[model samples]
Target: MNANELTIAEARDALAGGELSAVDLTMACLTAIDAGTPLNAFVHATPEIALDQARAADARRGADAGALNGIPLGIKDLFCTKGVASQAASNILKGFKPEYESTVTSKLFEAGAVMLGKLNMDEFAMGSSNETSCYGDAVNPWKVDDRRLTPGGSSGGSAAAVAADLCLGATGTDTGGSIRQPAAFTGIVGIKPTYGRVSRWGIVAFASSLDQAGPMTKSVRDAAILLGAMAGHDPKDSTSADIPVPDFEAALTGDIRGKKIGIPREYRMDGMPAEIEALWARGREMLADAGAEIVDISLPHTKYALPAYYVIAPAEASSNLARYDGVRYGHRARLGQGDGIVDMYEKTRAEGFGKEVQRRVMIGTYVLSAGFYDAYYNRARKVRALIKRDFDEAFAAGVDAILTPATPSSAFGLGEMAEADPVAMYLNDVFTVTVNLAGLPGISVPVGLDAKGLPLGLQLIGRPWDEAGLLNHAHVLERAAGFVEKPRKWW
Candidate 1:
């Protein structure tokens, strides 16, 4: 296998054994990035920074090297990377570079990981498809005939890069279903830890309460390794959890015997594809075979999750994004001769934000408006509380983890839903939005391929801060499924 194709765990072993040099591994990844141009997974390439870090890692190789020493990773564009572009795939922040690194990136660097570049994402993480990106859609390396499919979003580029071996792993942020959905679509492992498990200090905001950063990787083991280096309490972020981060890699015992896995009957939505249903059934059998007891559970509010998420996510996004007015930094529109501050603000936003972003902003503004706030935003918040309560009840009833399909369907072709009703695209997160609403840890494990030969995944939702247990459950499912299929290198 090529050096760039190594998983984080495999690369770490090779680097420690002196069989692989950090410089050589980085060059291999850089070469892959150059060849992966057609996929547009990387919006910004930082080869100089990557090489410098790799060289430093080589100089400091020792028994005490960090877990990620010499590992190469792709940073999501939403992260502030000191001198690298951190636009969050939006035109408003075009050419903008942060003077400091995000807490997540800083932790990774401290653990000796090297940055490949900023990966593309949905503009402000407001869309489910990567086409909303100003850099164009990050195509899935997996294609059917001549049609290109979406890698999923807002962490689409992270999913694509990791799946296609463009990087050992990548950082991804999940608000609704960004990380898990893309991981499912691209047939990789992506985990969104509990809402506050990872710091949001230097990440560009989408929905403050819902957004959480996690790792996208080739396998469940790789996810655990990368997440170990990325997760820790941070004083820089007010919402960051003060709890200790456990040894995630040590938790993968592969013994899930006697664990209780809940299968929510509410997840069986009407009009769902037969293939997705079959995949879910197979996932249940796999876990049962591994000695996990499958029990039927009820989350009655599941039907309302999508509406509540659309409302709450946009509401928070509107408030968080208010800082991007043409004032402080980033893109500012050139005003006409007699134009005032208000004109510049309006013009700048209109010109900078893409259609999808503008649409969400408007929806958010409407929901939060004085006349409708109580009817929409407040109502949505109430529903969100109920959704959380549903999960709490399930856990309180002794459920170890909840299992559900990661997405409603496998990846659809690019532009397939662009002209359709926007609500159609939002439906993609039906199974996932509930996890974010509950502020719990969740992971997507590839379980099987659809009739079309596209990959499908099963989601395992765990109790708050129980990523270790959740990962183990997913590891069991991964082992049982043995999903070793990779996207044919059409790009």
Candidate 2:
């Protein structure tokens, strides 16, 4: 197996047995990244710094070895590191370097994992195709024709790096479907924990309520391990959940027998690719073969989820991004003499934000304006509550998890969906967004490949703070599907 492609569990066992050193693993991944530069998977890399951290991990192995003692990992550019660029994949923050580190990255450092530098992402974590990155978009490794496949965004670089073995695991943020959708596109595993489960301090804010940091890896066990390393309460973030963090690595027993999994009938939408529907059906059969009972259920708020999510997320984004007025931080406009403060704000924002981000902020401000607050924002909040209630009811009804297709279709070629109305792009997240609106944990695991040979994914959503259950179930399905093998590299 490729070194960066090893599962966390697999890597840990080998490391403990003295079969691999952190330096060796780090070098292997670095070599892979060097080879994959044409794929545009990494925006920046710190080879010397990464090796130094790896050597430190190797030195601590016998004395204070933790689960990730010798692991090499990637940090998304969204998080602030003390001396790293920490640019949120936007030109606005090009020279912004924080004096502090993000809670998740700090935790990963504390976990003895070697940091392999920052990965690329959609500018401000805003796009679905990753083409919105200030850096170039990441290419999917599995396209039969070697044409560009969106390794989906805003975590596209993380997913592409992990899928192509550029990183063992990369951190990702999910506001809507940033983590899970990209994971699906790249045929990797990604989980977005319940809102507030991971600390947000020092992560460049997109949407306060929706932004969450999680792991992108090649397997269920790696997801659990990375989650264990990244999740916990942080005094810096008031919203960080104070609940005791479970050892997610210990929960992967691979025995999901007798568990009742719900197959939400409402998720099968019109125009869903036939291959994806078949993949979802095959997922149910795999869970059943593993002794799980599959039951049909309805999340009646399904229709409202995407609309509600779009409203709330963009609203929060507008408020959160208001801080970058171009004076105290971010790219300030070079104003001529007599330029007023209001004009400075306008020019700065105009130069900084991309078209999609500007459009979203405009929609957000308008919705929150007195004329439409009640009609749009308030209603979306009510629908968001109903979405949560729907998930709560299903879990209360004894469904261990909800199974659905992670994406409605396999990754499309670059520019294939360019002329698409933004609504069409937003609908790409239809199946995954509801899970975020409900603030429930969900994971995407590779289930099968399309006839075109691109990977397809099945999503498993669990109740609030139920990451352990989600990971175990994904491993169960992952084993049954046998979709964890390496992809053929085009370059």
Candidate 3:
């Protein structure tokens, strides 16, 4: 395979065997990123930094090389990469280069990964279709005749880059299905570890409690490799769990002889497309063929996950985003006659935040307002707890994992849903938000193609802190499905 097409593990082997150098791999990815500009996958390209790191990795060969030595990775704009413009795809933070690196990025770099630059995302990780990005919606490389589709969001660019072979893998943060949905849409693998599995320090916050960083990669094994480098506790983040890190790649034996995989009845929503149902059925058969027992289960509170997530995510977002009030770092409005600090704040925010972000912030502020707090936010929290309890009950009954469709449907055309009611866009996360709400590990694995020839993914939700097993089972399903289709590079 070409350097850009090599998966992480394959590249690692080639580098170790002296078949290729780190600089060659990094340059291949840079060339692909530059060539794939039509897809808008990467908002920033750091070829110099990537080369420097690649050289350093080559120097470290046979000395103290790390597992990720000589690997090239794309950083989703949400993760704060020091000296790189980490905007989270929002205009408000335009030109805002962080002085410190996010814990996840720092760890990856310490493991000798090279950064190709910041990938695009939804503004403040707020939208489901990546249309809310200040950089314009990231177009999925997978397309129908003359119609470009969404890569999903807010990790859309990460998905697009990986699927289009612009990068072997990328960092993606999941909040309300941002990572998994995009991975599903683009025919890649994405995993959102438990809420605290990866540190949140220095990652631009959308909803603090719900946000988690994970990996988007070409295959389940690559996801395992990247996740091993990404996961672990950090003292800097209070919410980060103080758990021991495991060798995620080593755990992928692809054997699940007696695993109980739950098929949640609530996931069978009305009007689900026939293709999605067929894909889910195929995924179940694949897993069952691999020796996993498929059991019928019910998450009774699943119906409320979307509504409750909308209320809770935005409420936290409103509080977290209040810091970017133009008085501090970020874009500030030019003052006019009679315009005081208040006017500056209003105008700067009005000009900075995109429409979907403004709408969510307003919804959040209203929900958290004194008069509405008890009625909306508090009730949503109660419902959120019930959702978690439902998953807890299922796991307590011996279900090792839950299987469902990763998305309601395959990749839709960009701006198709955004032009309609915003709620219609929110429905894209219907199968995904519950995992975020429950703070569980979930992965989207491409298993089949739909009628339009776009990929369809199956989601496997796992017990908290059990990502090793989750990835192992996903590898089993991935092998059984054996999906190897790639987008016919329109870009």
Candidate 4:
């Protein structure tokens, strides 16, 4: 059997049943990563580390084996893996390795998962398309009419690598739809656990409050399996919730019966594609058929979520990214003759940040500036509060979960909007950002195919800290949709 083709759960079963060895599985994935370089999914390949971990996992085979024993997975560059390059796909962090492992990654390793490598992402986790990566765009394995497509942004590499079978699953950090959007584009499952459910202790910060690390996998069951290992309260992250991590995999009972799933009217925006609307209607029908009650709800403040997200995320990013200004660590600029520290700081940041990241930092600085703080940043926070309140009200009204289309449409060609307005790219996160804003758990499950044969996903937003239920509902959706088509190996 092709080891790389096995899903995480399957690999675990195989390893436990002595049908496969972890070393063989890791080597198969490494070979696939080497062969699939055209997809540009993994920026840094860690063969030595992967093989070492796999051998150790093999040694732990019997009653000592853990839940994730012998599983091979990908880690997004955002996580600070000890001794591994943890740059957030930015030149700013060139060759920098962390001294400590991130809380999430360390936990995964303890559970016996091996890391394939660091996946590509939008530099500093900015932008909607993966075009902004300093390593260049991660080409989607899916195509339309022979034209290459984007795998979606920030976590594009994570989604692409998993979908292409380069790895069983991958870690993805979501700061306003990064995980779910790319999962939608790549036809996989990506979940953004409620804020604090997954500790953000060592993941590179984009927007402190919004940034969350989650799992992107080939199936809902795989996502649940990985999330079980990745989610936990860490004392290192003050915001980490002091809650017990549930057995997310065991929660997949396929029983969302009598659940009140809300269909928000605001998501039915003007000019929404007929395909998305149709897909959402099908989702409602699937849930209802499974005994879930579909209810129409209103999130009145939804319209302001995008603008508010832009302002608040950037504001937090500006503060979090200030550490990269040529002082303590990361890249430092070559000083000109007799150059002052101010000049060094300016030159370093100008050279370090990409165009998109720079634009956000400036916008963030501007909004946080004295005169505009109240007018822009403060108001955006208020709007964000209202958005959260909207979700809170819905949940309080007995809404068990909310359903919507994950993206406006299916994957588009890479560079399709490079010449167009940047806002056009930001609009791709329209249906996703609200979940982050409200700090709710959200999952994207591939539900159907578009006319062009690309995957389309439906999202389920759950109550805060209700990831088990969210995954249960997503599992139901996944089984009902039966979306098992893999991208043809064009890369």
Candidate 5:
């Protein structure tokens, strides 16, 4: 097997045993990345940076080697990697390279992980499909016929890179279903750590209350390993919890016996595809086969999740994105003869932000407007509280974790819903936004494939700060399902 195709644990063992060198592993990935360029998984390829880090890792391969030593990873564009273009896949941030690295990247680097480069993402993490990215859509490696399929977004590039074995793993920030949704679409593991579980410092803000950095990898075990390095408290991010980050890899005992996995009835939406329904049923059986008791549960407020997420996410986005005017770093619009500061701000933003971003910004600004604040934003906040309460109630009732479909369907064609009503695209996040709203850890495990042979995943949402338990449950499901199919090397 190629070094790039090795899972984190596998590579770690090989590297430690002196059977493989970090330079060889990184080179294998760099080669795969070059060949995989048609997929656009990597927006920026940092070959020199990767090799330098690999050499450094080789030099430190003794007792002091860190947990993620020698792993090569693709960082999402949302992360501010010092001296690297961290555009968040938006035109506004074009040519903007941070002077400092994000807390997650810093932790990974300290753990000896190599950066392959920045991956593509949605503009300001605004869209469900990767079509909204300034770098164009990152194509899903799984294909049918000659049609291009989306890798999902806004972490589409991360998903594509990991699934195609272009890297051992990748950093992905989840705001809504950005991580899990794409992971499902690409037949990989993507976990969104509980809000504030991983420090958000240096990660470009999307929805401050909802954004979280997590790992997207080929397997649940890899996710656990990568997440371990990515997670921990940071003094810089106020929301970062001071609690300890457990050894996530050691927690994957794969014994979910006696665990109560909730099967929320609200997730069985009307008009859902038969394949998704079948996939969910198979997931339930797999867990039950693994000795987990599946109980029917209710999260009534789920019906309001999509609406609440749209309102809340966009509102936070508006507030967070206000700092990108022409006066600051990044793209600045040229001024006309009489254009003043206000005109510059307007022109810069209008020229910088993509259509989806502008739409959300406008909606956010309108909802936050004095006249409509109570009617929209405030009401959404109240609904969000109710949604969170629904999950709390389920957990209080002895549910160990909640199981649901990761997405309504498998990967769709690139432009499938782009031109449709925007609401159609929003529906893609229906199963995921609730986890973020409730501030819980959630993971998507590939369970099976649709009739079209595309992958389908089941989500496992755990109690707040219970990623260890969540990952265990997912590991059990992953083992039971035995989903070993990989996307053909079409890219």
Candidate 6:
């Protein structure tokens, strides 16, 4: 198997056993990236820096070092890497490079991981398809036929790279299904650490309350291994929780016996693809066969979740993105002839943000404005409370986790959904947004491929700080599903 096909644990074992060196694995990914460049999954790559890191990891391995000693990683551009352009796939921040590294990036470096390069993502992590990226959309590396597919968004490039074996694992951020949706599209495992469980410092905020950085890899155990290295509290991020980090890598038992999984009735919407429904049934049956009990549960506020997320996330985005004004930082558009100071600011912002970003900022401003605050923003907040309450109730009733389809369908053509009504694209995230709205941890695991052969995925969401439980269940599902071991043509 290719080094990129190996899970993080598998790679670690091989690296420690002297079977593979970080440089060997890094070069393999570089070769894959070169071959897959037609897919445009990565926005930037630093061969020299990557080689240096590989040399460092090899040095550590020779000295008998850490758990993640020779893993090569892809960092989503959303995470700030000191001296690397940390643009969030947006031209607005085109030449910007942070002097400080994101907590996750620094932690992984401490664990002896090699940084391949920054991956592409939605501009400011906004869209459902990577189409919003100024760097260009990442093509889904799956075949829904002989067509271009969207490797879902925000984290799409990260997912696409991992799926194509361009990298062993990649970092991704999820505000509303960003990580898992792309993982589903590209056939990989993506886990969002429980909100606050991972530090947000230098991650480039989207929705401050919901945005989280996690790993996208080949399996649940690999996800766990990567997550363990990246998660921890930091003094820089006050919101980061001080909870004890668990032995996530050691929790991969491949056994979820005596677990109670809940199927939320509200998630089975009318527009769900029949294959998706069948896959859900299959996932549940597989779990039941493993000595688990499946129960139908109600999250009555599910209908309100997407709406709430749209409102709340945009509201926070508006406040966060306001920092990008041309005043002191970011892209500064040229002022029109005879334009005044106000016009300079206007022109700068006009040129900086794309249409969707501008539209969301307008919507955010409108909703937070005096006239619409109570009607839109405040109502969404109240609904958000009920959604969290629903999950709390389900967990209280002995449901270890909630299961749902990661996405309503498998990967679609790159422009298929983008050209149709924009709402069609928004609806794609309907199944996964609720977890973000409720501030719960969730994971997407590759279950099987659809009739068209594009990969489909199953999502498992857990109560706050229940990531270990969620991953344990997913590890079992992953072993049972056994979809890896083969490669498909990139769409």
lDDT of each: 0.94, 0.87, 0.93, 0.93, 0.93, 0.87
Which residue pairs come into collision in candidate 6? Answer: none
State candidate 5's TM-score.
0.99
Please give, for residues 263-285, the per-residue lDDT of candidate 5 as tens digits. 99999899999999988998899
Q: Model 3: residues >4 Å from true position, as ranges?
A: none
Model 3: which ten-residue window has the lowest total lDDT? 61-70
Task: Estimate the lDDT of model 2.
Answer: 0.87
What is the C-alpha lDDT profile of model 2 across 269-386, one tens digit per residue? 9888789888888999999999999999989999999889889988998898898888886699889899999999999999888877888899899889997999999999999999
lDDT of model number 3 = 0.93
TM-score of every model versus the real structure: 0.99, 0.98, 0.99, 0.99, 0.99, 0.97
Candidate 5 clashing pairs, residues 3+ apart or interchain? none
Candidate 4 local lDDT, residue 96: 89
Candidate 3 lDDT over 302-372, as tens digits, reads 99999999999999999999999898798998899989988998999999999998999999999999899
| List of clashing residue pairs for candidate 1 | none
lDDT of 1 by residue, 173-211 (tens): 999999999999999999999999999999999999999
Model 4, position 358, has a per-residue lDDT of: 92
Local lDDT at 332 for model 2: 92
Error of 5 at 58 (Å): 0.6
Task: Show pairs that collide, candidate 3.
Answer: none
lDDT tens string, model 6, 1-491? 77767778788888888998899988988888888887788788978888998988888776667667778899999999999999898878878989899999999988888888999888999888899898888887776456778889989999989888888899999999999999998889999888888999999998898998899998888888889998888889988998988998787776777889999999989878899999999999988988888999999999988888889988998999988878775688887689887887788878888877887888888889998999999999999999999999999999998889999888888788776787788887898888888888999999998887778899999878978888999988887788763447543
After best superposition, candidate 3 residue 177: deviation in angstroms?
A: 0.6
